[model samples]
Target: MKILKSTLIATTLLMGISCKTSNNHKAQETGLRDAYKNSFHVGTALNRDDILQTDSLRSALIGKEFSSITAENIMKSMFMHPEKDVYQFDMSDKYVEFGEKNNMFIHGHTLIWHSQLAPWMRSISDSTEMAQAMESHIKTIVEKYKGRINSWDVVNEALNEDGTLRNSAFYKTIGSEYLAMAFKWAAETDPNTDLYYNDYNLTNKAKRAGAVKLVKDIQSKGIKIDGVGMQGHWHIDSPSIEEIEESILDYANLGVKVAITELDVSVLPNPWNLVGAEISQNFENNKKLNPYPEALPDSMQVKLAKRYSDIFKVFLKHQDKISRVTFWGTSDKESWLNDFPVRGRTNYPLLFDRELKPKAAYDSILALKK
Candidate 1:
């Protein structure tokens, strides 16, 4: 009887220890911000619903997993300054307040871009008028959020795939010099904030060359050009790991920091192999295209896990040049790729699944330092 009682006590002690261990592990799984704490700033772009605090689970997940926030669309020209005579700062105030309350690094997505421009801004004809308008736009926004927003994508997607200006209204009326002008006005308004010239497909030589030239031109004029945001709208394997690393180093060589901005690895097949994140692109929603409309295959989940691991390995290698690695959205459900290029296609591109649960991709990223 005594022997049996001793054995039972030992078993109970072991069970208690195991339960404690499991509880501790569950508490530790706060995701990216905790996993990559020392490596770089982990962030997500906030959708309107997220900023408005409408989704409690998402807001909590964002606070737990991310150390930074980007205004996905609220700060853009179309949303914030839709009408020529009107500028909306109400929704934006909530965004800033959320970031402040959480102590997350707040960032402004863009000051100027051709796509998503208000119709009024696009219709300007005179060079002088356009320049004056840009000056007001940059200065007003920067001054409003000067001390709060640590960085600004001062000029976004300004380079063509072939390393030429996009012939945007800013470029058309003000010439390519408008690129420098935008950055200059932004810097003068808030020199303390990190000024970034953001664009996509930095792995492409022509676009890379164009960005290097643009930054160098600004620097030559003794203006501030702090970093380059290499928008990480990558696929499962299209952009070779070598190309990504090369671009990171190339941008670092230009005497500027680098950021892997707007990151999301799409598992879906690209409609036309779209190279950049142009908001105007779309396609008819065919059943064939939205193959994973309801649920993703188990095999593809493994592929996504491996892809995230590989990309993060490169990011860890070039941590010196990179400032932040921001996911475009917090969960797979919120990924804009779902409706971009084609609407109604389910895209499992983010770290968390639709239920706001972490996936194997999350585990893979966490295992990088191991």
Candidate 2:
């Protein structure tokens, strides 16, 4: 495939050329976006917006590339089951329907997690009841969207920072067996959809080894595991490039597809200043960048874009092992970083600035060539 150039003039020229062309459209043209177009499945998790009414965002993605739509909070156990015994499917089903309508693949955010589980799920004392509930929930959700959802996060953050099974509710009730059971039940429910294990900090040596062992262990038990999702939540300075590339290879060596899920580079208060007064507050336009500031420092923002582009460069080099790459949020305004660590602090950590305009990172992503 010929790589698309990132220049505005080149993009306009390509768009015009692609508009008049038909038979020659490549995978990068028809199904995915060219490197210059942010085409590697650019997407955002949705909750409140009506799929039919999201013309603004829909129009924006027309020529951009994206892999799938991930129902971030929608698919999480807590969001699906805010109350005990009363599961909601309206929102999630809408999300999948939207993806299908837009010719976008759908990825289930998660089936199991230590966080965001139903309240009653936490109170279950009997192993049988816990296992039954888990199986039922997984079966119901997976079956409901079987053909529609192309991929699923079978388990989320299952391992501790040290790479051991987290003593979460599921582990406490059914032991480590729950991981295998969750994948088995999900696969049984939807034999075609890809199943994945997703987590953060997989770039660390111990964490990477733990993920490798987890995949091998699950495969050893004859479970239907298909992928490993690395939550690429990097900061401007952390998660060295060497660690990121090595982790991708480790997961692939175990015979599972790898994905950079929940990718975003946090440009908040620097980590070194974590103990001091919050540094994020100093960036006055942080909270959603309301009333876009004119004459902002171009160099700092350019550096930020380079950071994102560098990561994409790494991703492109390992595209053989990677199956998908999903951005965490649609815009910097909607990023989770704003509230994380310190609530109400503004942070810029995504491809688009507050005005839905592409940042320098956009230039870098477009700079990628096949």
The TM-score of predicted model 1 comes to 0.91
Position 120, candidate 2: lDDT:
77
lDDT of each residue in 172-224, candidate 1, tens digit only: 89888888888899999999999998898888988999888888888998888
> Highest lDDT among the candidates is held by which one?
1
Q: List the residue pairs that clash in candidate 2.
A: 36-366, 39-65, 41-65, 41-66, 41-67, 42-66, 78-116
Candidate 2, residues 218-291, lDDT tens digits: the string is 99999889999998777877787887888888898888899888888876655334321122333333544332
Worst 10 residues of 1 by lDDT: 13-22
Q: After superposition, how far is residue 51 of candidate 1 from its true place, in Å?
A: 0.4
User: Where's the lowest-lDDT run of ten residues in candidate 2?
Assistant: 271-280
Which predicted model would earn the best TM-score?
Answer: 1
After superposition on all C-alphas, the RMSD of every candidate to the true structure, in Å, is 8.0, 7.4
- Candidate 2 lDDT at 94 equals 78
Rate residue 11 of model 1 by lDDT.
58
lDDT of 1 at 316: 98
